[model samples]
Target chain A: MKFEIIDYKDTRSGFGEGLLELGAENPKVVALIADLTGSLKMDAFAKKYPDRFFQVGIAEANMMGMAAGLTIGGYIPFTGTFANFSTARVYDQIRQSIAYSRKNVKICASHAGITLGEDGATHQTLEDIGLMKLLPRMTVINPCDFNQTKQATKAIAKHKGPVYLRFGRPKVPNFCPPDCEFTIGKAIQMTEGKDVTIFATGHLVYPALEAARILEKEGIQAEVINIHTIKPLDADAVINSVKKTSCVVTAEEHSIYGGLGDSIAQLLSRELPTPIEYIAVNDVFGQSGKPDKLMKHYGLDAPHIAEAAKKAIQRKA
Target chain B: MPEISELQAIASQVRRDIIRMVHGAQSGHPGGSLGCADLMTALYFEIMDHDAKTFDPDAINRDLFILSNGHISPALYSSLARNEYFPVSELATFRKIHSRLQGHPATKEKLPGIRIATGSLGQGLSVSIGIAQAKKLNKDEKIVFCLMGDGELEEGQVWEAAMYAGANNVDNLVALVDYNKKQIDGSIDDVLPLGDLRKKFEAFGWSVTEMNGNDMHEVVSHLKQVKSQTHKGQAQIILMHTEMGMGVDFMMGTHHWHGVPPNDEQAEAALAQLEETLGDY
Candidate 1:
């Protein structure tokens, strides 16, 4: 693996742009926003398709229920809000109207993870992925970068069931292959190595890629896999990659308690009991600070992932 | 207005269906079903103007009715079937395995009259608002009607929806609260006091109305008067007062029959008191 200093872009911008495109391409694609329409980068969609856009005015629960009903009359509804307001604030609404009834809805959340910055613990929702993944029919996607997030937004609309697409505010590097195809449950192997397998999602995927570059300098072979779809996990890809590497490091922007790491651990524990280590927020809420400082405090930075990978490799050996 | 004798006959048949269906399946919320028998009968027999025989599930030109308090599915199912939405014989399959007459109202099993799945409280009003908004957007003249439980209003989401409906002036919607006073746990006042429902609706910018939900004549007259209240830049809220279990002698006064199945003897006794006005399934 080789290190490359890449240009960065915010994934939220990707989601907003994609939403506008969906609105243009399909008249049925209607959007609903809470007060964070500008923050979620949904202003473009809201401006261009004003009739199709609904300003829900800080009422996420009403937005969710209305989205469910909008689907009844054949509208492909996309609900935009902060990750916290989209999930935790309206878990029952999403559970009963959307997931339980299996409505065709896209719940696009922005400002996920510690990268949300300044707004603090209340806004930084690391537990959203865990809460959404527990839903039976929800397709949870925490894409790695701008391109991947945009691809996911389009992909989820074509998908018939409920989807939870999470993206962050920070301007991370746009490093994925520009024209790469995106299949919802398929894991993309960003870099391949032999010593350890690193499975990461959301903002952590970029960090894992960084750690892979750092490890290569030390002659430590690391295989980086982006577990984009958290719910219908790319199990075969994970297991196959883990078998080659013989050790695993699972990373995510969510809590270590019940997010991607937990799902991967559950999978490896049952079939292939590999030495697995995690890089995620521990049982604690984040506070107002720079995104980098918050990520470090939560133990979810590239250095933390690099250390976790080394630990897993040593444990496996 | 529908004749009192005819309305009484429909309600009697609906009550008979409620008792038999609950007994046949050994499950369901008979208390609320019996409680809303007159309301359902009034709506189907006289209030909602629709051609029941031509059942278009999403007919844009026809009026839409939603049972937000979906636990009362037996009453709704009986009303729809008797109006010929489906074969009335399907009543025998209530709550049984592979039956379209699910414990709650559902559209999943291709149930003709059910527009959406409901059982989880506080969601139906929001859905009804969405439907009403759609009707307005489409310039459809038909009204959207939804029935909700007084207890179901305790859900915070319901209030959120109420706020949105009032703010947006969703005038095409008519929301009826079954103010039966009793809930599954106990009386709503003991569980959680709902202070002045009509005032709350009025504060929320709704045209509030109250009616004796058990009185067929009042139900019919109020429904007609409320239609004039529609498209007036405000939503309509009807606080309907009724007993929890209205038809059966033993079940009427208490919340005991809320979700309890009637035993064979209890079923027979209840049925004997109510005549087979439209014949049993």
Candidate 2:
């Protein structure tokens, strides 16, 4: 149960790195940023592939529609912006043009959740996963670290449908293997235990693993699984793990109402009934704070996940 | 070129199809549909250099038209059908369940001519600009045309698109606003007046053209003139002037008919005005 923190890396940089790689590999790949190229770490891709990059200056709704239309000409368009601006701000733009039309547009959203920090509630988005996952034909991915975010970003490009890849701004623990293999709609098991299952996504995934190791010392075994791809969720993988554990805890940096917990609850309630505890922000807006402090204040850190895991295990009848 | 009378004949039939389709479905926007009949008839029939024989949804090197104001699906469906995108008989399934011609334009049904699902108002311009940019990227010499409703300008997304199209030099796109000044709620002036549309478009850096959209010859000539003006680093917009219900005598000049379907007697009366030129579906 020992692991080394490889380094701290912002997830948006991973997305930018993946976009640059995609530019070299696929000629049909094009990118559009809503005047946040530097913030999204997309300057390299924009500079390297000038012909493929479109700077749509601060107009996110237009960016979404343009991305949808790019698919009409057989081009894969990856749109970049903050999570709040990406989803809620342009929900109809994405819904009608991209999701409903089944356009091959990758909506890459960074600065997700309260981890966007000092920008306050307006900039942070805790309901984007809920917004995106409800759309039909939308693949929602929330990778844990830089490596996984980059891998997820690259993975969505090859997928011929609408995808929402959520990442963050802070440079947290980048512990995932540098060359990790990423598959869409598949859950990656970080730890195997039987007392309780901790299903986590996005930035909270790293904390779930840390919670698992801490719980091991207390003679409690927590099965930690990273449910990166939320929609078309790895239902079989989830059902299998819950069957063995018989109790579950879902963690995310999103609202407890409709993020990973809702998706997993729907999965377990229909397939196999299990007691579940949620490690997410209650229905409320975020405030200005440091990223780490925000996670602690919102009770989304490792200690919160560990406590939730224990509560879930105790609730199992 | 097809005779102007021939185009007018097709428009006459298209107007018949518009009311009949709406009357058959028991719901639809007939006013704008009838108004744009002439413009779309010319675009699909003679102006566009598109091959109607083979329908490839992903074909390049062909002029494309998108109905942004999707409630006018009747006009787009009739035009696409008569131009050989699909069977004219399918027009009967306008808003029926399991019909490809949904109330709005969509690509999910894999409808031949529709490249993107529009009608969410204010979104089509941005999408057209995307295709125009794609045409530029591929070095493909084809123009992208989008039709919008005058009332839809109230949505901020349209202006966002308008701003993007001009600033990005999306010259390969030509957008047309159906200036019937009618929406579902009421007349655009009574509801939300769009003060000086041409000036607004000009301020957004678009090369604006004002024409009588209901006139077949003006529609054709303006489309051709705009095609020549593309790629000059300025997007073009045609602020078309037409009556709310252009072809129908009783329905013109009022916003009341914007969305209301005609009853049996009214349908008969409306059909009496539009001659059955190309035969009914």
Q: Model 1, A66-87: lDDT tens per residue?
A: 9987776667889999899889
Encode model 1's per-residue lDDT on B29-102: one tens digit a residue: 99999989998998888878777777665557778888888899999999999999899999999998898988
Residue A58 lDDT in candidate 1:
74
Per-residue alpha-carbon lDDT of candidate 2 for residues B1-281, written as tens digits (9 for 90 to 100): 89989999999999999999999999999999999999999999988878867765655888888788998989989999998788999999999999998988888568888878888889998888888888888898888899999999999989989998887778889999999888888888899999999999999999999999988888888888888998788999999988888888999988888889999999999999999999899
The positional error of residue B124 in candidate 2, measured at the CA in angstroms, is 0.6
- Name the lDDT value of residue B224 in candidate 1: 89
- What Cα-based lDDT does every candidate model obtain? 0.88, 0.91
TM-scores, each model vs. reference: 0.93, 0.99
In model 1, residue pairs whose N, Cα or C atoms come closer than 3 Å (at least 3 residues apart or on different chains), thus clashing, are none
Model 1 spans with C-alpha error above 4 angstroms: A1-6, A177-180, B1-7, B49-62, B84-90, B96-100
Query: Model 2, which residues run further than 4 Å from truth?
Result: none
What is the lDDT for B147 in model 2? Answer: 92
